[model samples]
Target: MLLDLINIRKVRRAIVYFGLILAALFFQNTILAKVPILGVTAMVIPCFVVAAAFFEGGVWGCVFGLVLGIFYDLSLAGTSLLFTILLPIIGFASGSLVMFFLNRRPLSFFLVSAAALIITAFCQMFALLVFSQTKVLPLLITGALQVLWTLPLSFTAYYSCRKISGLDLSK
Candidate 1:
């Protein structure tokens, strides 16, 4: 009976992981990309990664980040190795912070989302500064803008996941 319960729990976690992945890909390819922004665009996949980390901590958050990073890299046809390193770092950092402050207060949710966006933006900025040929200032500016745009979305996703999963983060 105990083994059956463990299996069921594992299955549930797997389902949630896959579901988040599909949702991330769909949002990236369809919803976020198709939005007719005049000149600027937001990085929805980062927001999704942030949401995953905020809601599901520990190894799950890292896994989500790694998977989503690979997907994002593949879809963009850019270097996959860079994102494979960056995304998981962003995920693990943000998720670790969330886990550290697992209080279920409304404020906690807001803080985590903000932290996720900030961390992701910083990662992008650092990567551009170190590896990419792009100008550092523009990358930093755009990353900052993207973080602002993504924070609200991350908050909504995190809150909704908390509600649906019945996971009390306030402890």
Candidate 2:
């Protein structure tokens, strides 16, 4: 009976997380993308992944990352497997780092989220930089702008997941 209850709690939690990802996906593609800061959209997905992974642990982070990536890939154009490959790694790394090294705090989230955002922005710009003649200065500026724009909003993910983590599953 206790095992079944634990499984049910986990399933419910998974469902909630899945819904959160889908909602974020909708917000990202529809509302967030349209609002450009310095001609660059805020990539909120990384914030979601990093926050969840940080709060949930490595396995949950990986699973959410994979799901988010698959949907993200399907949503975007000309970027086939980019996020499908990257977010999971970021999620797993973020989760593992939190599990072993970092404490659950806002400062830690900021630092880790910033690092993840930097890597994501670099990978995105690298593809364009390599394939085309986009200048380094412009790409760097845009990436920095994106990170700045997205970082503030990342608190939403942090607080939300923190609340989720606080839930009493033992009940």
Candidate 3:
């Protein structure tokens, strides 16, 4: 009975996560891209990964980030290597912060989400500077604002992950 319950929970968690990623991808590509806010669209996938890290820790974070990144990269711009490498790093950082110092609070969620976005921006900036012979300052400035625009929704991701993972953050 105990093993059955455990398996059920695992199955439920998988479904929840898969659903969340699907929604994020759908929202990002279909709706958000068409109607840009100041010519910037939100990337909710990383927020989902960060929330998963905070709730389930590094292993789940890494796996989710890796798989989602690959799926995302197969269609989006740039190479697969960027998202594949960068998102897992964000997950690792989110997991580290959660494991070492933070709880699954909204504040923690916001901070982790913001950090993930900033790191992603930096990585993009670095890639642009290295590979593309184009100006990166504009990208940096806009990316920072985009990060800010996306930060408030981290709480939504955090709560969603907690509900999906069947975790009680109050404990």
Report, for all candidates in order, the number of backbone clashes: 3, 0, 0
Cα lDDT tens digits, model 1, 28-135, are 678866763444455666656656666677566688789877877787765647567767876787678777757545577567666666666777677568877788
lDDT of 2 by residue, 1-171 (tens): 778557887898999999999888997999999999668889889889998998899889988999999999999887579899999999999999999999878899999999999999999998789999799999999999999999998888888888887834235
Alpha-carbon local distance difference test for all models: 0.68, 0.90, 0.79
> Clashing residue pairs, candidate 1?
103-170, 104-169, 104-170
For candidate 1, what is the TM-score?
A: 0.76
Cα lDDT, model 2, residue 121: 95
Q: Pick the candidate with the highest lDDT.
A: 2
Candidate 3: regions farther than 4 A off: 1-6
**On a 0 to 100 scale, what is the lDDT of residue 4 in model 2?**
59
For residues 52-76, could you state the per-residue lDDT of candidate 3 as single tens digits?
Answer: 8988888888877887788788768
Worst 10 residues of 3 by lDDT: 35-44
| TM-score leader | 2
